[model samples]
Target: MRKTALLIAAAALLGSVSAQAAEQAIHIDRQPWSFAGPFGTYDRAQLQRGYRVYKEVCSTCHSMKLVAFRNLAQPGGPGFTEAQAKTVAAEYKINDGPNDKGEMFERAGRVTDYFPSPDPNEQAARARFNGSLPPDLSVIAKARGVESGVLRGILNMFTQYQEGGPDYIYAYLTGYGKPPAGEELTPTQHWNSVFPGHKTQMPPPLTDGQVEYTDGTPATVSQYARDVSAFLMWAAEPHLEARKRIGFQVMIFLIVLAGLAYYTKKKVWADLH
Candidate 1:
């Protein structure tokens, strides 16, 4: 069986779909996303803001199944106080156990609990998204669409192309389609992407200065999206810091091992040669 990595952990929450604005599709104005050699790490401040953004903005319709509140205080994060985490955790609750009559009970979440999802399973997600499953964000950065490098998106026999790299994500988010003033939206072209490309369903989830990044990060719309995307990527893969550290240690040991092998080979070959 193919192993679909589902536990990577990630972000976003949806709201009432009825709240969407009129179908005004905007064109892709500029390239925005990049991944290769990206300099997108969320220092403590950015993560804190990103966390706030997720909770206040994106948590309604989506779910983050992998992260618990306690993870916030790790090596390179906001380090929320236990009291702070509990306050945040109490915002949601889950089924605790059963009553004598066999009904489920409820309790506020502790920092140790995973996030409560809006829906129970894929069927619920599809029902919520008009039949499209909202992809889990845990590993979305790595699960990047192949067309991520294309400036517009994958070659559509129908429309323009995507620019490659992180700009792909950047363009897609900002690319909400705007009708040409006169034309009404066709059902096919109805929903506008905040990013330029129509392939994305997410609206522009950021605003100028919506998030206060004390890390001196830019507060532009695109900058917020980029930072939050990076933040989500890191949350989905919290082991990355340890992974990087281990990789460095392994590489050093291999280098030393290689040097020893080379010297032994030279010593053995000296008499034979």
Candidate 2:
């Protein structure tokens, strides 16, 4: 009877501790994404819309340095045609090199050129944004870490929940709203519920009707967030589909080879047995 009471007391203590932790923890909302599971592929239209959001809104502060202009036309990516990509590239002026006069000059960007930085250097970027530098968006989606607790990890393994990056991006982008009544914000800080500690250096960048979507999708902030997040994910993992396909093929090959080996061994051992 004493041992049973002790076990019950321990259980109640654990329950109270868990309840307190839950009350103190920040909850990040998960967004629905197309490219989330093992067999997932990017939505081409959505990627294009995302690219538009990036070009019009996010590009003002963030540089996608890792992606070249030509990558837009690559297969299993944003599905931009060669002509379309070239047209897009022509919109930006790229720094080009030494001519007969051995002087650097500006030229229309080509497929070979990487996306240019808005600011000349880190110092300039920081100064422009009130001592807070805007991060390069090329891999920002991948850079954000997922808050996968023990229970979430087990659930994700079965659910194939690989949208942590994009989901976090979407949540964070849409998370900006009016602060709580008593919450005080510094002059340079903006309130974002999804952000760590609920404060961010960057202001809310997106608003309704910010970018005109060519495909007639709604220009709401929510849509913009989702599309841009998806685009960033594709930029970070351009070869994702190809990698998955190759991995699947390898698994199939191994299975077939194993079956053949098993049959051959059985045949060889039949006489000995």
Candidate 3:
């Protein structure tokens, strides 16, 4: 009986594992990003287009609370001029408080102010979305990532493939579609091929020709997804280019130091030998 029980437990555990594997069997194809690889840098034009997408669409629900307007004008970023950033900041109204009247007041946003949330508070946001709080997009590209299979993971280690987060974002953005036959979804839930459990509270956020692009870039859903994904990546790591440059410099310095140390060691041991 004990042996029989063990067998049953083993079978149950195996079944659970199989179920989990099936649930996690999502496949997301990797995308080529401008800021990928050790020596790669961000494309300024792409970043700018991405910012437009985020501002026009994603910002309606998601907040980028960690990013300040001044960041838009920083070096190694979207390449916006300080005046342009300031102008953009002034377009938004910020809530400030406690003047002589001891009451809250609304004022034009400043360069230092972070992006405002669409809802006033967490509770308000949850209530507005029927208990689903829209996530902040500040570091979303860093927070979300996809797993490569064992073989690909091993290869990624050598290739320095750290764009999984952006790839997942891009896939998720484009993964929306009609549910498969016999699949039931709640009124609020939507189908997403890349999302876990194939259901998401957020509906398809993009449509073809929804956001206009002035620089001759296509205004399609795919283009919007790619642009916004890249922008989110930049928002998550504003100093990525600088970090890569410094890392490369440090590597060269280490190589030269290693060579010098080898020669020094040989010289120091010559007489002893």
Candidate 4:
């Protein structure tokens, strides 16, 4: 009875959350992603490309302070070799403490360093973006996206359609264009179909051939958006693949244990009869 009551309470909470999400009435187009199922894994090559997109383009404005340079060389990530990661780290300059002079100095980034922000503080960031502060990319992918409705959430519990973050990112990136016939945008605002207000302060950030791709992939706007979105998703959840792997193992164990318990119960009851 206690378990049943807990289940009912959970259902009610989920229903409220789902209803709230529906009331917002936002539309986010779904996209195909490599990591979308029980056995889903990050595509190393894709992650590398996504990193390139972020480094060449997104890093100019957004900071990923939570991620370390060494993460690039870690397993289940962008798959950069340690040497490559070190080389990439060296490309950026980081501020370090005084060397006996009580003065700060700039030096090449180390693997332990976090990605630097373009501005020194929020005031500077707002000044750069016309009074709007740029959000951190550390967990933007996970931060975006809507909750699934009650019915869809239940289905997702089984099917694992957990591409909401990447899908929303892709859609938002590609969702920019001119506003409708009568719609007017403020001077600092740009039209975005997927943005909550249909207008956002940030302008469209990508274009065809905006970032040169070393991997021979076409540098289309859509491609850049998708790649960077995937990269950001990985940044937000570096252990996603491992988590899914462990989850599957646990599920299998539970199923096997349940089967064994059923058979054992039958055997004990049979002897009694």
Candidate 5:
């Protein structure tokens, strides 16, 4: 009787675990990013469009505190000219240190200045968002990722699939919609199919025809999401291209060295035999 009772309890526990897993299962489709494989690099035009989307929409709440204006003109980035970067910087009013009068002052932003936060501080940000603080977007692409199951994780290891972050971001941006039947959300909560809990404090941030693209890209919510996600990836790893190049070179060198070592060993063994 005791053994039967233990078995029943174990079955119930397994059932509960399975139910929770089903509730939390979020399927995020992989996106075909320009910077996906070993030899891949970021697309300049796409990054530029992504920046536009962020500036016009995401920047209103999210702060990119780690990015400097000069980075926009750097190699392997959004392809802005130095003058253009300077112009972009000048549009922002940066808070400066105390002047000779020991009073805090505002000044035109310089290329060296990092992008300022949308809110002055954490308290202000929380107050603006109904007690939910907006996350800094500087490295959000690197910070957030989806879990690939055991089989998919093994495949990703072999295929060099390092795009989980961008895939999650893209899925999340496009996942907002009405809650499923029987799933109720409060006014402060929005439904996102890709979000971990299927609910988020952030509402639908993008709409159709929201940001203008001079490059003739479609002004749709999906396009905006793709662009901004790509831009965030670039921000998280500005040196990705260079890193890949160096890794490739090292692999080639190792291959050549291995071949030489094998031939030399065979020659030495042949003479001894």
Candidate 6:
């Protein structure tokens, strides 16, 4: 009888704990991920495809306002060439020279100029965002910690770009979901990611297999997410490759030293034993 009671108690305790865990744990549900490469590096073709998607589909509403044309051709960048980068820059006009007469006016873009930000300052930005502000995406992949190694660094670049997607950028871009079972959304309130408390104002950005891809990588929503995430990762941390190389050397040295220490300890302890 006592054992039965104890078992019942244990089961109840476990159930309670599970319920609490479910309630308290915030599931980011990091949209599903496939290994881009061994450690997370994406293929060049994937990155380019994602860029095309961004140019064709995504850039319409959100702004990549901080990057520059030259950055495209920079080391560890999109690996674009100077001519290609310049052409891309020319496609988007940035404020440049003074307009008619002596007065200044918005002019075309140059390779050196950074992308324009959506807002001039924080207050205006927040007002536009419903007391929230969209972040600058230049370093978002890296800032979000996807730039751990060569593959991860590349993959993290676009971690914010896909669905089954839990990230803010992804959520922000592909906004809209029905409200919970009973609760209702106000006309203006968007259903938020389960993490943050807001319905995304941004609308769904892609149709299934919306992006035209030549690489023959899967063209599913998940693949699109992964590819874009990788691109974003690269954007966020351009020097991660170099950093990864240095870290690898340091890790190798530390491992060798640990082995040496273990052997020396064994030798020293042998006499006592």
Per-residue lDDT of 1-273 in model 4, one digit per residue for the tens?
999999999999988887777886676767878888878888888898899889888888887889999999988898999999898889998999987999999999999888888888889888888888889999998898755667777997788787888888898889999999999988999999888888888889999988888889998999988888899999999999889989999999999999999999999899994
Residues 57-94, candidate 3, lDDT per residue (tens digit)? 99988888999999999999999999999999999999
Candidates 1 and 2 compared: the better one by lDDT is 2
Query: Candidate 4 vs candidate 5: which has greater lDDT?
Result: 5
TM-score for candidate 2, please give it.
Answer: 0.88
What candidate 5 gets wrong by more than 4 Å, as runs, is: 1-24
RMSD of each: 14.0, 3.1, 5.4, 5.7, 4.9, 7.2
- Candidate 1 at 157: error in angstroms? 30
Instruction: Return the lDDT, model 2, position 45.
Output: 97
Tens digits of per-residue lDDT for model 6, 165-210: 2153443344445677877766546675542555555445666678
Predict model 6's lDDT versus the native. Answer: 0.62
TM-score computed on alpha carbons, candidate 6? 0.64
Supply candidate 5's per-residue lDDT for 198: 85
Residues 175-202, candidate 2, lDDT per residue (tens digit)?
9988899999999999998898888998
Candidate 1 TM-score over all chains jointly? 0.65
Cα miss at 51, model 6 (Å)? 2.1
Residue 46 error, candidate 5, Å: 0.5
Q: What are the models' TM-scores?
A: 0.65, 0.88, 0.90, 0.88, 0.90, 0.64
Backbone clash total for model 6 is 19
Candidate 4, overall lDDT? Answer: 0.88
Better TM-score candidate (1, 4): 4
In the range 83-137, model 5's lDDT, one tens digit per residue, is 9999999999999989989999999999999998899999999999999998999
